[model samples]
Target: MFKIGELAELAGVSKRTIDYYTQLGLLEPVRSETNYRYYPEESIERLRLIDALKKQHLTLEEIKERLQIIQNQPDAADEIVDKIEHLQEEMKHIQEELLELKPLLKQLNEQQIKLMTKPLAQQGYTLLHTLAILLGGDPFIN
Candidate 1:
């Protein structure tokens, strides 16, 4: 269990955000004997999901509805876990590819770099796309 402040820090959100979510019924925290609210470790992942949905332009109500539907699905948790694992594996592969390209990247001049990346950029797969994919975000959103 974590205090509200701790959870906020861990989830990269503000304490007020968590409080607001709690008020909105988006987050549920347990009350201690001291009347302090404490969140479970899973809250971090929940906040991250909420943040991701917001980035996808989902309204709070829409996000809540989606989350409720996901919760009601028996296999949703397992599917999400599988997807996260797959993404981690892909990130590892990307890291290895970047390592392999390090020497070549260093040797490339500005024009050569632009030439190498231009095709990918034209295909909407620029550095931002790579970052979005790595961060489990929808690359095509922007």
Candidate 2:
């Protein structure tokens, strides 16, 4: 068993972060008589996995939910694949929404072409307008 400090060093996170993970039941490090935390080698792997999942921006609750679902399932591999396929479909839907915005994009392109034939000073303003249209407001914004 490794002390909290040792485990933190091994995991490349602060002791406080490890403590927080323990509080969230993400890790189950044992406590000594003096109430010092101690973690096993397997806990290090768990910490690494939790860190990786957090990097994907998933909430701790979401991670816990996923873990529970994984634990309750018999075919974990197939369940994970199904979740991935669902995520892919969501991504495809977003892409379709972007593609459906093509008419506005075409109009913007025409404006850009018009600006290109104009004087240099006018081109800057038109470029700014194009950028504003592409990035400034939400497409569905009022």
Candidate 3:
């Protein structure tokens, strides 16, 4: 959970923007008994999606409607949110593993690096495509 300021900083937006988004029903923050609003980490991904849409020339009203449609889908929004959390965890683990392997990877020759990545290239492209889709980009892009 993140406070408004924390979420604003993390999401690369202003607190005013968050407030405006909350008002527009784009961001849903939980209010505690003390009246403090706490945003989930998933909000960051949502903010990313909103930014992506805005960049594509979507107005707040259109984005809100689109989000409503997405939320109305039975289990689809929930499943995607759950998947995003799981994917974030997986990405953290992969980042840690990559850091641990950095030294060994650095020692590999060009040919050896190519040999190792050959099998992973397809999987890497698939992951990229999936992420692109999640961020509302064209999946067909290389």
Highest-scoring model, TM-score? 1
TM-score for each predicted model, relative to the true structure: 0.55, 0.48, 0.53
Candidate 1 structure lDDT: 0.77
What are the per-residue Cα lDDT tens digits for candidate 2 across 1-142? 9998999999899999988988888778888999888898867766655665565467997676655665476356354545555755775796797687656657667778566446644865665566456433444447
The Cα local distance difference test for each model comes to 0.77, 0.69, 0.81
Could you arrange the candidates by lDDT from highest to lowest? 3, 1, 2
Cα lDDT of candidate 3 equals 0.81
Task: Give the candidate order by descending TM-score.
Answer: 1, 3, 2
lDDT of 3 by residue, 7-124 (tens): 9999889999999999989999999999999998878978876775575466898888767877677356656556656766788898898788778978999899889877778888
Top model by lDDT, which number? Answer: 3
Model 3 RMSD, rounded to 1 decimal: 7.6
Worst 10 residues of 1 by lDDT: 74-83
Clashes of each: 0, 0, 0
